[model samples]
Target: MSSNVGTSDSASIYRRSRRQPLAITSAVIGTTLEWFDYSVYAAVAAWIATEFFPSENSHVSLLSALAVFGVGFFFRPLGALFFGHMGDRKGRKHALAATIILMGASSLLIAVAPNYTSVGLLAPVLLVVARCAQGFSAGGEFAGGAAFLIEGAPEKRRGTYGAIHYMAIIFGNLLGAAIVASLIAVLSGDQMKLWGWRIPFLIGACAALVGLFLRARSTDTPIMQQAIMAGEIPDSPISETFRDMWKLVLRGVGLVCGFTIVTYAYVNMQSYIPAVTGLSAGTAQWLYSLSLAVQIPLIGFFGFLSDKVGRKPLMLAGAVLLTVCPIPVFALVATGSTPLVLLALIIVSVSIAVYAGPFTAAITELMPRRTRYTALSVSYGLAAALFGGTAGYVVTWLRFYTASPNAPAIYAAIAAALTLITVISTPETVHRDISK
Candidate 1:
């Protein structure tokens, strides 16, 4: 009897150890690929503007392209509704697998899309449709991926595990920036505008294939499995979430607001820097990529720290810094010096990383497992659609209207203030049992 018991225990331990790494990889790689696809669009936004929205007035063309970028975000909430329902009703693995395939197809579609010169209005329309598809896929990626990690993680280390999702996101952005920088370095201005922009989208499509394979092979989280066996999955997760968990949903929106604003502003600033400071696009992209690379380690460190020190303190501090530092950082970028611009980006990246590092765990812990995915997806999707998707457009429009380079910073500060309020009001969720 004792030998059989020991054998069973050993087998269970071995299986768990093996499964954990694969789950982590699936979560990270899948999210990374989706983010990479999305970031590619922003990284090459300048080239895309010229190619797809050719106009006598460059500003008008750029604004039109950005508006389309924002348009994609409007569809995210709908995606959340659909995918969130799937995740809650079917399983996390199923939802994640489906999202990856959808995102991959959309990215591939963008690679083959005709430019405005070739197809007239249909060109931008196709681009809009592709972006919306990507938005829909992304709507569920973060929440579902985070929920998967959180549910699988040991209670004490959920923060550390959850941080991997954000790390993947930064890595994805870094990869996108690197691709854009490489193209800019290798291609002439005309070459890049004509054909180079499509290369990143193609790369994104290929990477998505890899993510899809990994996610498809991965097993569902144990918590999700238990729910399935018990037949405890909610029939109407969206309605249930809104009915019982509205406060948690509101809190999620508030916490996500600053993150969306800061992240989008940081990304959009890469394009904005070259426009205002007269730096080469290659330099701006390289600096942006380097900044993101530096933040990856810092994000990991903070994620581990959140497990020890608590999520709220780090998040609150980050919110305070974001509220205070945007103006100074933008001033440094305006100097047009490579080193100063790099420094400015580093400062902003660090602040954002601090908050982002703990965000996934903190938000996921706020609700019960039954509606966790839906609640987080809906709130995050709404926040992103409202602020993140519109960030580049809003900043550009603000700068255009006010004729001030500081407009983006001012916008970030306002968003940060709202997040600060939310952080102050919400309790720390680091110790909560997600399985409840």
Candidate 2:
């Protein structure tokens, strides 16, 4: 009878162990769906803006549209603080589920908003409001997902699990790009500008609902639950994170410089280039989507390598390569040849993935369990806003002033340099036990 009892208990434990992997998979998928929902707006901005904004000057319209893109970043830190606090104080599973709901609601709102033709200034205002809500919800989604997977996975496989989260991000980007590309392929320009542009957002909103449902079923990490039970959890996570781990936050900002620029180039600038630099929008969309699809496998490969080679070396190499490569890379893209542009995009994408693939593990490992969500959120949100969110605006503003196309490269170079500082300061985190 005792033997049977022990066997039953062991089976239960094995079942839980199995559940953890599925939970992490859900977490990754949830985050990807959420971010992909946010990103599709930027991917289809030029078309959406023309349809909705109806400005006489294309450059001014694109700039206004992209400015609205940055507007979301402004709210991210606030969302990070609010949701990060909830994650640390409540649980990762709960916070993530809530964020998905908020994200989905905002996306749905955007999909159904009226155009300027129907509502005048109210159209843009509503768009900003929806984006702000999304920014706030997304602020904590990635950080929570990172911390959850890191804490839940076995120590030896933390890098692999953590990499899944980033894989989801790249996957989301590809999904968004593919959705937009497919629409463009079928629709005429007038049709796309008028109505087809909203389809991706509608799809994203639906995906977010699926993610929310999956997140509802995910279990909380054992470490977090134990901390709560032991009363070791802080009453106020944001204050505690700031007081205890400001250094880590600074390092996060520095690290984000590299991460953000790479993401900006791949996601934001892919669409921006055609609008601003005279590249064909159709060709740019296809190449960007194609390059991203090819790069996804490479991200997984590099992420696995990060565990063996150590996160620091890969990050350092990414920083160095980005610092030197941005100017020449952007110059080549400006030439308007689809082949050359695709080649340059892929090269930069591969170089950036070396760091991005491991960043979730590296950054989350730096903060203690007590403050992991808040610390990661603050670090990622602020850095992303400063560098990544503002990339298109700053680059365009620079181009407008200097009448030079080289300005975006300069922005990329500066951002990469900040990442170099982060690599110097950040220690390797692979295999670190979060329970400590």
Write one digit per residue (lDDT tens) for candidate 2, span 236-312.
Answer: 88888888789888888888876687677657765666865667666777787787777777767766788888788
* CA RMSD of each candidate after superposition: 1.1, 1.9
Q: List model 1 lDDT by residue over 261-366, tens digit each.
A: 8888898876888877979888999999999998998888888899999999999988888888789988899899999999999999999888888888899998
Q: Clashes in each model (backbone N, CA, C under 3 Å)?
A: 0, 0
Ten residues in a row with the worst lDDT in model 1? 34-43
lDDT of 2 at 330: 80
Model 2 Cα shift for residue 91 (angstroms): 0.5
RMSD of 1: 1.1
Count backbone clashes in candidate 2.
0
Show where candidate 2 strays beyond 4 Å: 1-13, 276-278
The residue pairs in collision within model 2 are none
- Give the lDDT of residue 281 in candidate 1: 83
Best candidate per lDDT, number? 1
lDDT of 1 at 115: 94
Q: In model 1, which runs have C-alpha deviations exceeding 4 angstroms?
A: none
